[model samples]
Target: MLDANLKAQLQTYLQKVTQPFEIVASLDNSAKSTELKSLLEEIASLSDKITLKLDGKDERKPSFALNRIGENMGVVFAGIPMGHEFTSLVLALLQVGGHPSKLAQEMIEQIQGLDGRYEFETYFSLSCQNCPDVVQALNLMAVLNPNIRHVAIDGALFQEEVEQRQVMSVPMVFLNGEMFGQGRMGVEEIVARLDTGSADRAAEKMNEQAPFEVLVVGGGPAGSAAAIYSARKGIRTGVAAERFGGQVMDTLSIENFISVKETEGPKLARAMEEHVREYGVDIMNLQRASKLIPAAEQGGLHTVEFESGGKLQAKTVILATGARWREMNVPGEQEYRTKGVAYCPHCDGPLFKGKRVAVIGGGNSGVEAAIDLAGIVAEVTLIEFDTRLRADEVLQKKLNSLANVKVIKNALTTEVKGDGSKVTALVYKDRATEELHTIELEGIFVQIGLLPNSEWLKDTVALSNRGEIEIDARGATSVPGVFAAGDVTTVPYKQIIISMGDGAKASLSAFDHIIRNS
Candidate 1:
C-alpha cells in the first residue's frame, strides 16, 4: 500500500497533468479493497485532470479498455518492464503520448486529416526482444496518426487466435487487419503504405481466396526445396513470399552446407529458385500471404490468401520463412549495419581477418565465432550482457583457452560508433561498474540469438511457446494441408542442412497427401 506521503505526492503529480488522462484500473477485489480504492479517490479529487474507473469483478475483462484508450492520450503499463516485452510497452506509451515535434508538422497534419481506422497488429513471442524497434516504429506512426491503433498480441497468451490466423513467425505486422509486411520495414515505407490506403486493401483482399495442392509460403531454402520436390512429383505447387531469399540473403557464405562448402545465400537462393521455376512451380515474389483458411471439411483443400488482391488454393502448405538475427536495438546499430555491424559470423568474420572484432552474445554461436575469429583476427572481444556465458561448458572452456579472445561479462552495448559509410568502433556500458568503454573493431558480429519468422501463421498453424512453428516428424502441422520446415519450424537444430532436410521431408509428405486426395 502507498503511504500517505506517497499518496500526497501522487496527488500533486496528478494536479500537474493538464491533459485528460484516465486510470482504468483492472485490479482484482484484493487491490480494490486496499490501496486501489484509495488511489482512485486520490486521483478523482483532481476533477477533469484524471478519471479513475475501477473494475473489481473481472480484472481481465478490459477488452474495450484498449479501444477506449485508443481515443485518448497514451497508456502506461505498470510492471517489471523486463525482457523483450518492456520495449513494446515503452513504445505503446510513446504512442499514447502522441506525436512530438520530432516529426515534420506537415506530415503530422496530413496524418491527422486521415479519418479511416488503421489497426496494426504484431504477434511476437516473449523471447523476441529484437522486435522492439518494429513496435516502436508502429507506435510512432500511430501517435502521428490518431486514426491508427497499434496492438501487439503475445503469441503464448493467444495461442488459439494465432493458430487460427496462421501466424508462423514473430514480428509479423498486419495493417488494418491484413498483413502489410513481415520481418522489418522502415518508417517511410510503412507511412507510404498507410497513405496510399494499401494497408486496408490488403486485409479485404485476403478475405477471399481458394485452396491449392501445395502452398509454399516462403522463397528461401526450405520453401524452395519444398516447391521443387512437390513440383517434381507432379503436384500443383504455389510459392508466395514478400522476399525471394528470406534470411539466406543475409548470409555472406555457406561453408557448412553439404556439397556446397562456399556459396553466398543469394546464390543458393537463386539456384533453388531456378530449380523450382524449371519445374513449373507457380512463384509469386514481393507478395505476402496475409492469412490461411482451413477447409470446412476434413482433408479438404485450404485457402491461402495474399495481400496483393490475389489468392491461391492449396491442399498442403509449407512454411520455410526461416529466422532473423536478434538485433541489439541500440543507437546507431541500424545506420551501421553492413558498414561495421553484421549478424552472421560465417558471413562477415573473414572480412575482418587480421583485424580487431567484437562478438555480441555468449551463446554457442557467439563463442564459436569468437573462437573462430581468434585464429583469423588479431583480437577477438566477446561481450556477454549477462553475468555468465550461456554456451556449453566445452565451448566456454575453449573460449577461455583462446589467448586472443577476451571475455567481457555483464557488458551491454549502448551505441554503435561509425561514419556514414562504415563502422569504426562500438560503445558499451559495464553493468557492474556503471562505467562506459569503447572498443575499436573492424567488425561486430551480432550472434545474440535467432527469432523464428512465425507470427503471421499464428492463426493457421500451431506454434511452440518459443514462436517456432509446430510440426511432426513428417513436417505436418496440427492443421491438415499445412506443413512447416526450416528454422521457423519447431526443429531442434537450426542448421541450414537441417532446414533443407525438413523441407525435403515436408515436400514428400505434401506430395503424398496430394496423391491420396486425387
Candidate 2:
C-alpha cells in the first residue's frame, strides 16, 4: 500500500480525470493479490469518476485493466506497477479517464488514424529506468486508439513467461506474439515502425523545408544546448536525433552533474529537452543521421542525410552524437547478446536473480554493477584486464566487502561460451601465467567504457585515433562551418556538465563563423 505522502499525491493526480473509468482486477487469493487489491481500492477512493471491480476474467493473476466506459481501450498492467512504472500506472488512469495527453497534435492524430488492431505486450523490470518510456508510450497509444491494446508485464513477477520467451533483457516488446524489439523505444519510433510509409513521408517533408542556420545532429545535452543557443540568436535551428537524451538515457544515477546534488539520467534528459523546446528550435526525434555531407563552399549550406531517406541542409552543423557502451567483442558475444550478454546491470540484473553472473570490467561501472548484483544474484565474478581495480577507493572497498563477489585481476575475457539457447559459461585467460579458466554463469554484464558515436563522421571530419572528432578550443572542426561537441569530440572528461559547456561554445563558434562569412 502507498504511504500518506504518496496517497495525497495520487489524490491530486486523480482529480485531473474528466470522465468515468473502470479498474477491473483479475486476481486470485494470494498475498500479492491482496496487496494489489488494497492499492486499487485506495486509488478508487481518491476520485468520484473512478470505479473498481474485483471480479475479472483476465487469465493473468494479479493483473488489472483500465478501460474507458463502454469503450474497448485495452491497457493492462500484469503486476503491481510500482517503482519506475508507478508513473505509467498514473498516466494510464488519467488518459483512460479522458484527460488529454501532452503529445504533439500531429502525433496524436497519427495514432488516432491508425487502422489495424495491435496487441502489444512489453516485458519490463520495475527497477529498469528505460522500461517506463516504452510502457507509457504504448499505454498512450492504447488510450488514443481503441484498436490498439498494450499489456505491460513485470518480468520479475512473471518468471515463467520470461523463461518461456527467452527474454534476457528488460523492455523487450512483442507484437501479436512475435518479438518486435528489445530496447528503449519512444512513441515516435513505434509509430515509424508500425507505419511503413512514414519514412518516405518524412523524407519528402524534410526535402521541402528551408535550410537551417544551425542544424544540430544529436539530441543529448550537447546538441540541446547548441540548439537553444542558436535558436535564441533569432536564427533557424533544428535538431535531428535517433532518440533524444542519447546515452544519458541509459545511465541510471548521475551525481557528478554539478550544482544538482543528485538526479536520474532520464529526469535530467527531460529537463534539458524541455529547456531546448522553450526556444524556437525544431526537434525531429527518432531520426538517425547516416551520413554527414559538408558544404562544398565556405558559408554555404551543409547537407546531413538520414537513414529514413531524408536530407536536411543547414548553414552550420554541430555534431554531438555522443557515445554508447563498448561491447566485449569476444567470440559468441554477439550471438548471445540478448540471450545472456547485457550492457545495463540496472535494467537486466533482476532477470538473473539467484543465478551466477559475471561482470566484464574493473572500473567504476563494473565494480558498481557487481556490488549491486550481489544482493539479487547468487554470485558475481568481476574480471579485469588490469592488475588492480580502476574504480574509486571507496567503491573498490565496498566491492571487496561483498560476500558474493569475487574479483579476478590480470585476466582477459577470451570468449563467451553459450548453448544455442542461453549462456552456459564464460572463458577467460590469466595474463600472468597464460592459463585459461571458465566460469559457469547464467548471465554476463559488460561494463566496459563507451565508444564514440563518430563512425559516420570518420571520413568527413578530422578524428583522433580513437575515432573521436578532433576539435579546436573554439569547438570548430577542420571542415569550415562544421563543429563538434560532447562525447563524440576530443573533449577530455566526458561528463554532462562539460558537454553542455562544449555545446554552447560550439554554437557560439558556429555563429561567429556564420557572421564572419556573411
Candidate 3:
C-alpha cells in the first residue's frame, strides 16, 4: 500500500518543477501482482506534475524508459524501492528535482533555438574514468543545444560499432555523423563544427596537393624508423598511413625492445613520431595508400596514389606495412580486449605478475609467450586448438616444466564472460569430447598468427605466398627503387629491435639505389 504522506511529498516536489518529465513503470505482472499496480496508481494520482505510465505486459520497456529518463530529467520508482532499487529511485528524484533550476532553464532555452540535427557518438574504454566528465559535458551540450543529440557508447561493450567507426583512441567525438575531432577538445572546438561555411572552406584547403622524394608506407616501428632515417639522410621523406603505430599501438607494454627496458605502446609510438618529426619527415595522418605505380622509365621514381585524393612522387620507396593480429572470433572476446584480455604477452605480462592468466594458441609464439608469462603470472592455462604444440622441443619442455602452466590441447575458446568492465572468466569446449568448462582468470593472452598488411602492394611489388613483400637481404624489392623491411617483408623474425635494424638497413639501401640512378 502507498504511504499517503510520502505520496503527498512527491506530488509537492513535482508541482514545484516546471520542466517536462515522464515516469515509466515497467512491471512484471507475474511478480508485481495487481496490488502493487493499485498502489502505484494511487501515488501517480497524487500529482498532475508527474505522469506515471505503466506497462504490465513487458519489463524490458522500463529499461528503455530509464534510458529516456537519462536524456530528460525524470524519476522512475520501481516496486517498493528496496535496497538495490532505492538508490536508483533517490538519484532519479534528484534529477527530477533540478529540472526547474535557472541554469537548466537557460540551457533549455538555448536548446530550443537550434535548427539542425547534430548527432555525436563517442567511443571510450572502461579503463578511462575520465570519459564520464566528457560524456556529461556532451550531455549538457545536448541540453543547451536541442540540435545536438549525444550518445556515449562503451568502447568495450560495442566492438563492431567501434571497429566500424575506426576508433583507435579514446575521447573521440563524431559530429553530425562525421568524425569531428579526437582526444580532449574544449567546448568551443566542439561548437565550431556547426559552422558549415568554415567546414567547406577547410575542406577546400585540404583538397590542395603536394609531392615528396621518398614515400614510406605504414607507420609502425619499421615505417617510422625508415622515415626518420631517410629524413635524417637529407632526403625529402613522407609517410602515408591510415592510422599511426599499426599493431604495435595495441600493445600495453614493450619490454624486449632494446634500450627501452619498459615502455607502453602508445608512449613508444608518440616518441617515435616525435623523433621522426625532428628529422623533418612529413607525416600524413589518416591517409590510406590505394595504389602504387612504377615510373614508365627505367628510373627509380614511383608514383603513389592515396584514397584521400592525394598523390606523391618519390625516387625511392620503403614498404613497412606491418601485420595484423589474427582474432579468436569468440563471443565477448572482442568486448573484453584490453579489459582482462590482451594479445601481446610481452606487453602486458608484467602487469599480471602473481595473477592467474590464460594464453591461447599452440604455435612457437604462443608457447614462448606462455613460458615467459609463467615466470610472472601465478597460473597459466595454455589453450591450444591442435592436439600437439608446434613449438620447438626446448620451449615445450620449459613450458611443461613450469609448476603454474597447464596445457589444454584440442580445445577452443567458446565465450569470454565478464562484467561490463573486465573479463572475469572464459568458457572453453573440448574438440574431441564436446565438453565445456569455465576458468576464472585475471587475464587472457592471445598469441595467434599474424596477417601481413600487404594487400595494397600486390600489383606493385612481389609478395610471397605468406603475403609478405619479397625483399632481398639488403631490403631491396623486385622493383628497382622499391624496398621493404621488418615483419612486413620476407624477414623471418618480427621483433622491435629487429624492425629498427631493418629500417636502418633499408634506408641505406634505398639511398644507394637513388644515388646510383642519379
State the weakest 10-residue window (summed lDDT) of model 2.
292-301
> Which candidate number has the best TM-score?
2
Quote each prediction's TM-score.
0.51, 0.98, 0.54
What is the per-residue lDDT of model 2 for residues 366-442, given as tens digits with 9 covering 90 to 100? 99999999999999999999999999999999998999999999999999999898999999999999999999999
Query: What CA root-mean-square deviation does each model show from the true structure?
Result: 20.6, 1.2, 14.2
lDDT of 2 at 277: 91
TM-score for model 2? Answer: 0.98
Model 3 agreement with the true structure over 1-518: per-residue lDDT tens digits: 54777666666655655444455555554443355456556645765555566653333322212223335421222234322223234334434534532333533454455567777766554333223334544655654554666655545444456555655455567766887765544332344345434334432433453545678888888888888888888978888776677666666557898777887665677688778888877776655778888865434468777765666678888888888888888898888776677766654454565778999988887998898888877999999999999999988988888899999999989999988777789899999999999999878888888888888878778999999999888999988888887788888988877888898888888889878887
CA lDDT of each candidate?
A: 0.68, 0.92, 0.67
Ranking by lDDT: 2, 1, 3
Clashes of each: 31, 0, 1
Higher-ranked by TM-score: 2 or 3: 2
Relative to the true structure, candidate 1 has a C-alpha RMSD (angstroms) of: 20.6
Clashing pairs in 3: 111-146
